[model samples]
Target: MAASNSIAENIAGSPNHKMLHGTLQAAGLVERLGGDGEYTVFAPTDAAFVQIPPVTREGWMLPAQKQVLHAILNHHVVPGRIDSAELERLVDAGDGAAILKTLDGRDLWIRRSGASYILTSGSGNKAVITEADLAQKNGVVHIVDAVLIPAT
Candidate 1:
């Protein structure tokens, strides 16, 4: 990906975004998150959101849920770009564990298991990085298989 494209643009340009673009835009977070400096967004695809319980996802889409949506999205972002190699090094220096501060003002624990990287939220919810090192202008995105929910 080129540095000119923001994380949202990169995702929107992706084939996967076709289905979720409207939802993201409707939520009013597209513009704020899109076209900014480089950022690594652990974006959840439409399918991933589908995996969420229907009622839960519905509740989150409500106008009152804006804060929650922002929190969830921000949880997926870290201030600076952190690639897998640097993450690995950090984990190694920390004895296979490191803490990543999210944009949501929460701490996410990163751990290395063999060759894989696992992210654990303060609530103990964990998600593994299924795809890493997706370079974007603002930062790098590491695709995760599951969503991480912070403790309420």
Candidate 2:
């Protein structure tokens, strides 16, 4: 396989990355996570943001809403590079499913649906992997269709 690019590079190269990267930076997670090591981020595309209630999105971006923003962002990330194949193997070895712990101290469940991978968080919200295997230096990024929100 070819070498993976850095998150910064990927953000710079992709139009979708621009807004996502900016949001992460504004939340102050970019620097801390940038140098930590590999991470697997379940990146929600701009289109995914549309799925969120408009007021919720506006609230998260507010300066006074930093804590909420951080939690939401962290909820989308796993500390290591958990590629799709590895995720499949893990699920298959554990009763056809497995629970992945997130950086935010929440559990994300992984399961298979025929050939597709499904991820679910505590509130029973599900996000399908619209695009997988975009490798980055700090980790891997899987683009999803919906935003993963933590239970309130």
Model 2 scores a TM of 0.89
Error of 1 at 8 (Å): 0.7
Give the distance in Å from residue 39's predicted Cα in candidate 1 to where it truly belongs: 2.5
Top lDDT: which candidate number?
2
lDDT of 1 by residue, 10-129 (tens): 777877554345546656667755756555566656666667788987777788987886677677778777898989888999998998888767988999888888888777877888
Candidate 1 lDDT: 0.74
On residues 1-152, what C-alpha lDDT tens digit does candidate 2 reach at each position? 11366665575466765556767876888775567577888888888787878887877888998888888778888888999888888998998999888888888887888877778867778888888888777788888877787776
Regions of candidate 2 where Cα sits further than 4 Å from its true position: 1-4
**Local distance difference test values of all predictions, in order:** 0.74, 0.78
Q: Candidate 2: minimum summed lDDT over ten consecutive residues — where? A: 1-10
